[model samples]
Target: MTTIEQASGAEPRGGGVEHVDVLVVGAGVSGIDAAYHLRERFPERSFAVLDAQEDRGGTWWTHRYPGVRSDSDLFTYGYRFKPWTGPSIAAGEEILAYLDEVIAENGLAGYIRYQHRVTAARWSSGDHRWTVEVTRGDTGEQLRLTTDFLWMCQGYYNHARPYQPRWEGMDRFAGVVVHPQRWPVDLDYSGKRVVVIGSGSTASTLIPAIAEKAAHVTMLQRSPSYYFAPPTTHELAVTLRQLDIPEEWTHEILRRQYISQYHWLARMSFEAPDELHTFLIESMRPLLPEGFDVEKHFTPRYRPWQQRIAIVPDGDLFAAVREGRVSIVTDTIAEFTEKGIRVGSGEEIPADVVVTATGFNLSLLGDVAFTVDGEPVDFPQRVTWRGVMIAGVPNMAYMFGYFRHSWTLRVDLVSDLVCRLLETMQAKGAATVVPTLRPEDDGMQLRPWSDPENFNAGYVLRSQHILFKQGDREPWTHMLEHEQEREILPNADLDDGSLVYR
Candidate 1:
């Protein structure tokens, strides 16, 4: 963590105000990565990280719902600069703790201002800077700040809006209704009948955790989701490291495990759908009830990876079902009744508590309003430059994680690349840099990274397009292949026709 010095001028000058080399919004995994790299590249320039929340860890801290855990393994989710020192697959608290450690270790606390929410940002072509308006959450005060470069790290989930499906008689229901994103901390479910709606990772994880105390737990799925179970710890890697294999070699082997799984899933999604379904069923057979039908509870109408798949921590969800502590109901939710919910299949299930884990509304680019020289820029109408920068937007970038691989995999690469780009620009005394897609490059028609229809709440659904776009050639096409990213992203031709410099 480097020391901070105040800019020479603090007051606003005409439309342009206090100027910084870069202004980063949101202090989550992406924002932190961006700031760290920016400092490494240009330590002389001024940069700041602003977050709406009072603390860091963006979504991890925002979401306090019970049974929260990462679907991806922690080994790959952590930043490259910092190694995650915990079990392979970590719980929500563990990940949050890691973020805290990174912030403290880097001494980024002084560089970040919490409770400052950016309302809008407009680029001035004449001045070659952005005038940003921010609202102070504590005092409802407004302040103006300007920067030459704007990096949007705020992710897609709407922090305020919880996705609760409209049921005809929801208001009349007697039981407490909650959304997983806004689970009340003081609420207790001891000896109560709880029904978790939706079949994604959240509900799957919630069922098993809640079943321990809840009298009966039921997972109501409007549609089935593919579920798979794998050990949280890798036995082979553990054995190899114990046998005196180098730790780096062990790490590489563990990373390869993730790559293999990612490729298998991609192939299943693009080529062999039936085989994928069969493989999942076969893997889950040992954990299912003696006479339960796999098709009824696990088979989804959509193709593999069409929607995000739910992963259990070593078959905990299936074990809970097998023990009769948790049950699954594959039926349409008809309406809310006085005591519970009524399904379209004409069954009324009684519950003391109901949790709606339906999904999230995608809010791209942190839902921040942007304008260029007082003219607003329509984001969706613009082309994505390498899936990171937007065409026609200068000195601006957005951090999007890998869709098919771990979130940190691409994030780390993007951070490194950004640092190098800054370094190159500074060396040449360039004021602004932006990447643009060639109009003749028909990359938009290429296969999308993930299924467009696959829906999940928060960051998962928002940045799905990143997967198919070429981050680099060959093995680096996927985020997990960091060696390729190290080679291509940091040292790539900065003067390429795609990037504009001034």
Candidate 2:
């Protein structure tokens, strides 16, 4: 990681006071999208995008482990406004380049200030503004900026640190141990016996890529996760390229088709878990050796869509197993051994290097402390307004993409909502726009954001209490389905009694 170089002149004219129409926190994908959408309507609105990271790409910049790529295809994950002209499944560097192009082309580079981590935000009812405190990473100096609106686009995961489990005998391991999140650029795993601990997408990607050079790679999983091999190239996109259709229209059509199929398959899995289960198993039978029990290594105990299926471009993982480069060990790690790891099955997986591709640490609103009118904001006590804004949080909207579908899908809708809300407020001559719950809304049933039935991701469950709840019904609950959110968030009346415009 590069050191954050502090820019000269911290304060503005010997004072920390500077005002803008909006102050955007975190210049990740969501923040970039928010800036683009806001620029579309309110180009004149003075806003700044602050990022804690030293560079442009947020998660993409953070995780540089070998074969780090999108969990979903880029076509869907890429912003709705900006079509991903790259491969369907793009690598981290490719995605980072895409972000760079978006920022450069749209003139967003100047507006973004890196190494400025937002610490606290206090909203004042009298001023109708947020006084946000940001700490410069290089210098210990703290700075303040006041803005009419606060857009939290920092994403939902904790990037400051990776979630490392406290395993027995971790300190005794002689060989190089690394988490995929903090992969050392100079570290070498060439011809080394490597064991990757986890079966999620990170482990899936790392094993195959490392197996090319490593003498052997073993993906050690507690159980199993559903695996799918999507074609590296979008066939529809390829076909459209041969024709005279504009890239924008072609991209839009393909995006819609992919999203539609996802919704259909997700519904089908719930309707007939048995049928889906059989189909998933049958699909991978040919990929393995004849009579190989794919059910053991590839089949997940839970139904589909419970957790996202681990995807690899063009069956890379399956091919690796078939070619005898990588192996899957579905057993719990008893403990980390000095030599390697000992499994619950009394199996000793000796390795020279161990990579823990465990999942991320969940955090809310970039884990920044928030207050309104001197009262602390408890997210769990508040219901979401279209799954974007917390009810009663004035002039504030945080972007949390769809867990079921590509995150960009929901972000697009929420960005549209933010632009429209701001436009409506300006038109109505309103200073404050808070999602004020109606008397009837007070009686609604609420559920945890990390509910197992709704979202079964492990990290989400860990930070459930820190997250905002969803009601049993609309505007309050997040319609995890993209089509549902697209229809609801964009079309909902801005003047509805839910939002108090004062």
Candidate 3:
């Protein structure tokens, strides 16, 4: 067998080895979800969790920028097992609290090793197990663990440093520059002119919030993003809670409605582009002033949901714009000037602070390296089997959420699949389960896994060629809708010849 390593930092092997039936690599929502199912499914098997961060709430814990909250409803984003007892759109702190509640309620805290960052994993055919290496964040010490199954719940991005483009004369600009990813708690933007770059969720949410305190806030966008202000609390969700209805039933009903509307809108965006675009523009009409240039400022050049539909809670962003505290400049940024940025129109926007809300750099499995029998596992060379597991990779799977829908919706289903997969392996006396492609599959047509034309987010477009591709059929297509995932994950035949057990 060949042995390779992408993990580093050597230390004395001072402790005895410990083995487990499963090693879940994360402590966030996905990791906690996986652990709960594993414990319930295999009561006798040993299991543990590892997380790189010191706290729970993966992205929720890291992104503490002003006005940072969920873009979707809490009912669907929250766990199905536990109902969210808070607002429909919750802040980062609230989500973290909910995560803590879940961990405490399930007694999963004792099983998680926080600050333990996993760097590499290898599958050994001879041993039928994986050797994993983790580096401690507090100390530089390295620890190794062996597991029969490896579940990757560590999300899909580099949160430590977000994408920062080099702006010309940025160093010479006499102003504070900050990315929304690393927001300083003590930052005082009051009475200062603020220019926020990008029209994505971060900028959309930040403009109104900072405008409340700043002298003026301008959302500088190269192109417009589709946005709509959904209610902060769904009237039905609130009514049901007040009427003493079981949240489970109410939430399930809400889930179906939300999913249907989302799917329908997405279908309309592709099927009838002009109609959908016109409808969306009309929807934004009441939010702005009567004579506002809604077409030029709010109307996007592309169809809705192609990237993402940014949501503002309760029309707060629009209110700020109407109040004249917030403004929008639709133009390309030429470069950074001494005071602010110069636009392609030859006009300069002066600001005391320039916030770059540009977005993240997509990195899979925390940028960890993997291998099987000593050969490096190049992900771009692989195809995403069922959108969760990979071909030729045994006893391993990563929970990459749906791009078109809420991440938790798909991850919840994936966690269930992992539990089901583990149970099926045990019942059949199997040591390893790997998805195998059929001989006929060799001739099937395929496309780039995440085509920019299909899912055109900046981070996604930049890294689509590096991700796993898929064929044109089921199990290979990996549909992104939540309804499709919920329907297919449970009832699908486990021994359907594509997933092989040995």
Candidate 4:
């Protein structure tokens, strides 16, 4: 109900610095969620959503590879406040449209500023505010802004540079080698032999989409990853629609159902991994060819749920393989020959196009330079406060979502907790709030941002040294399950010894 001007406390000083109550970074799903909560809870607070990308839909806008879609169901991936009337599994464009609807319905478009990238954030305790430096992607101009609170929703991975390892003779390959993250729109693969490297979601999705156009498609992987083939539409959702139930009712019902199912699956991974693994592999047997080596190509060395289980809607990937449009090769790459890639066994797979669906590098806070009172932030040495705020950092919260459940589930939870904290700050007449270590917590053992034992994805393992650490006790540790945090975050005490207010 409040315009940016009405919510702002300070006027622009000679066009040098503008002031807002809160500044949200990134216009993606998480940032949008944060914007909604802030406006709803503190309608009088001025805030702006800044994204480096040219448009909205952070990761959705950045990734344009063929067949890019959500591996998680839309029922939970969609916002808790919105109703998703589409199928459970949605394509990239569909997801973007969903985001567009949210912005239009909530009048959030006015608050979002595209092509505005925050490069540096410096907190000054003396002023009780943060001075942020931004670069305009549209124009080569720099801008400065000040805010009382900062909310970071930038995704974890680096969008510009993807992780592509060099092969023995990569330079000698005659075929065009492309990373999925940077797929070229004009690069044609039609009627050409395509070899996709790595067996993650990108590889699985690409093979099916490009298989029909390409002469032959092959999935080359160092090791297999677990895959699940859920139906595009949930039967309950379909039934609810047929019964004339409202879309909002259907969305809420399906969201809770998926959350419970995901919780159970995560539990099974920890309690009975072998049994769960067997079920996942067996489920794929009917979709694959009878003589296909499921154990060799579909089975994974690690347990299911350790890494994300790639969701293949209605077994499209398997259908492509079963119909002889695609093939899977499980072997390490020996080198890249002039024609194509050669495996460790000395077998050469000829291809006209080599798609390195390898993965991406992790970026800490969007690679922004952050300082607390002019001192650079050393993230590894700092402990996280409930995975939301970094300890000793004043009035800042970042959104790191759940790995076991849909990411937006955590976004909504974190939004609730943050809005409540803001309300507490208002009631107490505080200028700044920071998390600090109490005397009793001085000797607690510190752990990595993500426990390798719990979730050791390639990007996470590579970025541990640059990420914030967690502690052994509550209020300091993070990466909790949705079920657990759903109960703990709302009731968390603001007067706990962890937070210091002034």
Best by lDDT: 4
Clashing pairs in 2: none
lDDT of each: 0.75, 0.83, 0.83, 0.90
Native RMSD of candidate 1 (Å): 4.5
lDDT of 1 by residue, 1-502 (tens): 1112334223345544455778889999889888777766667777888899988888887888877888887767877677655667777899888888888887677778788898899887778888788887877877778888888898767788856678899999999998988889998999999999989888887788889999999999888888878787767767876798766666666776776777678667658888988898889888989988778888888777666667887999999999999999999989999999999988999999998988765566766888877777776456556556766778887787865567777887777766777777778888877665555554444333433454343445555543224323221123333444546665667676677778
TM-score of every candidate? 0.88, 0.95, 0.95, 0.98
Residue 312 CA displacement from its true place in model 1, Å: 0.4
Model 3, 39-71: lDDT tens digits are 677777778888899888788878888988988
Where is model 3 more than 4 Å wrong at Cα? 1-15
Compose the digit string of candidate 4's lDDT tens values, residues 1-502. 1112322334564455788889999999999999889878888778888899988998899999999999899999999899999999999999999999999988888888888888999999999999888888777578788899999999787998889899899999998999988999998999999999999888988889999899999999999999999999999999999999999999999999999989999899999999999999999999999899999998888888878899999999999999999999999999999999999989999999999999999999999999999999998899999989999999999987887789999999999999988998899999999999989898999999899889988888888989999999989999888889999998898898899999
Error of 1 at 198 (Å): 0.3
Q: Write the per-residue lDDT of candidate 2 for residues 95-116, one digit (tens) a residue.
A: 9999999998888887788889
Provide the lowest-lDDT 10-residue window in model 1. Answer: 1-10
Q: In model 3, what lDDT does residue 35 have?
A: 82
Candidate 1 regions with alpha-carbon error over 4 angstroms: 1-17, 240-252, 436-493
* TM-score, structure 1 vs. true: 0.88
What local lDDT does model 1 show for residue 67?
A: 77
